[model samples]
Target: MRTTTAPGDALGVLETAALLRELTAGLISAADFDEALAQLVRTCRAAVPGVTWCSVTILQAGEPASVAASDEPIRALDDVQYGDDGPAITAIRERDPVFVPDLAGSGRWPRWTARALALGVHGVVSAPVDIDDQVIGSINLYARRPGAFRDRQQLTAMLLAEHAGLLLAAVRGRVRADRAQPQPVAPGDEEVVGHALGVIMTQRGCPAPEAREVLRGASRALSIPLAELARRLVDSVARHHPG
Candidate 1:
């Protein structure tokens, strides 16, 4: 989303690999698609030096919405694009990556440009996360200055999208299976749940009792085994509040 003005820098091989490593490790214990996406946004914001904010748009059943956004302006910009038919929407619907070097001067998303300009955002690099041309979502990176992400950076972003696609498929697969029959806690659940609860305690400022109650509620609502439910709840919260 919109942030302070800055220029894009070229990333080296080592840097790129390091970013990939960090991103993968970040989502290792993620519970599902949403959790992974939340981490995806966090990872991009960290890896990209000038990226003061980030946002993601998940298109589910033809409706697109912000799954994770760093700020209100960023989320609102994405929401505007998602609501109408434009290049970003076309790129997503057509399963192609859309790169807008300049948002303010571009007429592609005329309304989007005005809105983005109002909030100080002036560029975008959108990478569609698609599975065999069936786009499930898109990662939209915005910047306050124009001509943000470059061509090679766009390629690296595609790598992120590829990993994200696989991550989502794996997580959603588990969710479907879990939904069919309640899931049981694996050995790693303790750590997963701990991390999740830590995020909730920090973000929501809830006490242990309330956090534990939240875990219990998630378990009952999802019909998951108690421990598994706790782990999932914690993992979900952690991903969105990694800061």
Candidate 2:
């Protein structure tokens, strides 16, 4: 099926860039890269309007693995795709976005389509996430309604996948470096970021991703690393509202 082009306003370039920047900073601030990746898929599920489930695939131990998923049960959907010609696999193979606007209308990947439809998934979009020039994976989004991912939605998913590729590269580099020289990590660092996110969300009445963007924006303006900024924020909040 042909992919539709998104209009200028469907998702402005500036907005897309901002999202990528925030996501990059948030990933860098994370204490555990794997858990951060899991959080990323969750954030994507929340950020994208029509996405019913989201998953990220990457090579682990020389084999494809679902590194992160929005919901644990949704991993079943990804499992069906791993050994089949599913959209996610095709997207990685072709290094392009694969769009299945309506699973009922398409005969491709019979196994995946049937499994998806049985689970109330009617639309799927898979975009390739390049780990490097040669290695690639995919970020897959599933929707419950047909035609859920139109021009704008598809573009959003693609942009997210593009940024996810960059983040994965960072993760891979970190893993290699850790294997060479182990680093000590602080306890409760993850909770610091989570607490800061909660504070931001409560203050702005926004979602976790939006709060993350706000935190990133603040970190940028203050010239502080995201993790440090989050720690400071949590400390300040505790000081003022001491229990």
* Candidate 2 clashing pairs, residues 3+ apart or interchain: none
CA RMSD per model (angstroms): 13.1, 15.2
Q: Best TM-score goes to which candidate?
A: 2
CA lDDT scores, all candidates in order: 0.70, 0.77
lDDT (Cα, tens digit) per residue for candidate 2, span 127-221: 88776754567888889889887777778878888787787678767755644442223575678888999999999999999998888777656
Candidate 2: 10-residue stretch with minimal lDDT: 176-185
Q: Estimate each model's TM-score.
A: 0.67, 0.68
Candidate 2 residue-wise lDDT at 192 = 80
Q: How displaced is residue 143 in candidate 2, in Å? A: 0.7
TM-score of 2: 0.68
Model 1 scores a TM of: 0.67
